[model samples]
Target: MIRYISLQNCPFDPGEELCKFRSESIGAIASFTGLVRSENEIVALSIEHHPVMTQKTLEQLCDMVITRYHLLGVSITHRYELLKLGEPIVFVAAASVHRKAAMEAIVYMMDRLKTDIPLWKKEIFADGTSRWIEQKQSDVDRSFSW
Candidate 1:
């Protein structure tokens, strides 16, 4: 089994990361890339985190998904610090022998990541106003579904 987790301040290439995550024995791979949206005239996103706790939480989440889905490989990458609109914020991928497991695992991982992680986000608008984002009930509901 292969498991990779990273929390960085720099931007990453999802395609390159996907290629690195590929395994010969894996028959299916499911991936997700989350980007900063241009909603509400948002100019940038500032992500903050407790470095140690954030990494630990992500690792634990990845391990749980790998075991629950019987995955052969898993990878998650998340970025902190300020990010411009439309920049990638996160990447998640799962590999398994069957397509269904991989797909479900990806969804589960993403849902968990949205709610379980220690990172916080602040949306900076074009008008020089910014606000810290709060977790949505919808995200909590989605994570609870699994």
Candidate 2:
């Protein structure tokens, strides 16, 4: 199985990354993209994480997904920095011989990432103020479904 995970300050193209996951045996690729929404008049979001710890945590998550779903390949890319409204924040793709496993892996990994990932985020409002974003109960509930 092929796996790639990266947390970088720069932006990434999900389509381009998915191209690398295509293989003869992999017939299905399930993907998800998380974007910064323009809610509450927020102008941007600033995300931070402990470099070493964040990478290790992400790798462990990918490993678990790959094992549970028997995926042929997976890629996860999350960005850190000040990102504007409508900007892409995270991209995940899982490939397998069939669609079911690929789809489930994508959802499982995203749900866990939303709650378990060690990342700090703050929303910058247009009024020149910001607040640290907290994990919501809804997100916890979603993870519980797994």
Candidate 3:
């Protein structure tokens, strides 16, 4: 279930869940969550889906991660629409027999999603100003090094 939740109240990190799921059969779990900061700061973030291509991009990313990691299982979720602060921006959970593979795959998927996925984010300010955060070219370049 490699997916970006897109619009769910996913507060609990999925990593622990994944670990528990695989505990009977595997030894390690890898997970990640992107949170919103405070100071007008957000505790979590919301995601804006690219209606035409976001889901497709996420699927492709999952496939790639699965192949690369040889993971026992995987799960990913992201919120869509006007998500408030402290909400979940994204969640990814993975389980593997080895910690190294799980950790590497987790990092790899995150970098891929941040750069390759077509999802967009609008940073809402306290003053009510909103701006689309541009994808950094350096982010893509960094993914390749992984």
Candidate 4:
């Protein structure tokens, strides 16, 4: 199963869930969590998405990871709109027949989300200053070279 999730109202217990559904057919599972940090001088973050485009981009990302990594299952969750520091921002889980495939799938999904997704974030400072931050090209470039 695959889904785009919101962390605000969802508990991403992918590990526990995977354990319950484990089979001899599946040998590995990898999970990743991204949390909002307080280091950005921001009191809150707002993520914006262009409805249809975001969903299409995310699905294409998932499909690419699945095809590239030979994953049995892949799930990605990203939080949107105003979010406080320390909140869960993203969750990725992948199941595969080997550890390397699961791990690679998670990494690929994250890279795609950061580079291809149409989501943008605005940082709102405690002092009331708001700034829109573009996804840094350098960050995306680094992913491919690695």
Candidate 5:
């Protein structure tokens, strides 16, 4: 499996990264992009992560999904620091010989990352207030249900 995992402080283009996957043996590539929203009076978001710990955790999760799905390639990029509304926060992808495998790998990795990763996010409101985003019940249930 070809896998790339990164936790960085800069913004990234999910579409560009998704276009980078190319393999004649792989039939499909599934991808997902997470973004900072403009809803709920949110102006921006601030993400905080311990670089070393976050990278290690992401790598382990990616490896698990890639191996389990026999993916030809996978790439996951998560961003920290300040992000404005509609900015891309994460880019996830999985390439495999079958569409099901590629789709499942991306979904599983994203679910686990949403519920299990240690990164923290503070949503900055338009009213000059900020609050930490808590884990969602749906995310937890989805991750544990497998």
Candidate 6:
């Protein structure tokens, strides 16, 4: 099994990361990419995180998902710092022998990451206003489903 998890400040190409998976035993790969939205007149987003804690939490989460889903490989990349509109913010991919497991794993990982990880986001508006986003009840509910 293979696992790659990173919290980076620089931009990454999700396609390049997807191509890195090379396992003869794998039959399906599922992925999700989160991008900064242009809605609400948002100009940019600033993500904040604790380096050590964030990395440790992500590693643990990846390990759990891999074992639970019997995955051949998984990759998760999350970015911090100021990100412009339409920029990619996160990428998650899961590889398994079956399509169901791979697809489910991606959804599970994203749901967990939304609540379990201690990442803070501030939305910057076109009007030069900014606000720290709070966790929505919907996100909390989604994580509880798994």
- TM-score each candidate: 0.96, 0.96, 0.79, 0.83, 0.95, 0.97
lDDT of 4 by residue, 49-130 (tens): 8878887777887787888887777777777777778777777888888999999788777877777888888888999999
**Model 3 CA deviation exceeding 4 Å by range:** 1-23, 39-46
**What TM-score does model 5 achieve against the real structure?**
0.95
In order of listing, the candidates' clash counts read 0, 0, 13, 0, 0, 0
- What stretches of model 2 exceed 4 Å from their correct place? none
Q: Which regions in candidate 6 have their CA more than 4 angstroms from the true location?
A: none
Question: Which model, 2 or 4, shows the larger TM-score?
Answer: 2
Specify the poorest-scoring 10-residue window by lDDT in model 6: 1-10
Off by over 4 Å in 4: 1-24, 143-146
lDDT, each prediction: 0.92, 0.91, 0.69, 0.74, 0.88, 0.94
Give residue 97's error in model 5 in angstroms: 0.4
Best by lDDT: 6
Give candidate 5 misplaced runs (Cα > 4 Å): none
Candidate 5 local lDDT, residue 126:
76
Worst 10 residues of 4 by lDDT: 2-11
- Order of candidates by TM-score, top first? 6, 1, 2, 5, 4, 3
Candidate 3 lands at a TM-score of 0.79
Query: Candidates sorted by lDDT, descending order?
Result: 6, 1, 2, 5, 4, 3
> Candidate 5 on 1-146: residue-level lDDT in tens?
56788787888888789877877898999999999978778999999987677888898888888789999999999989999889899999999999999999988989988877789999999779999998899989999998
> Of the candidates shown, which would achieve the greatest TM-score relative to the real structure?
6
Give the alpha carbon lDDT tens digit for every residue of 1-146 in model 1. Answer: 88989888998999988887656899999999999999878899999998789999999998899999999999999999999988899999999998999999999999998899999999998889899999999999998988
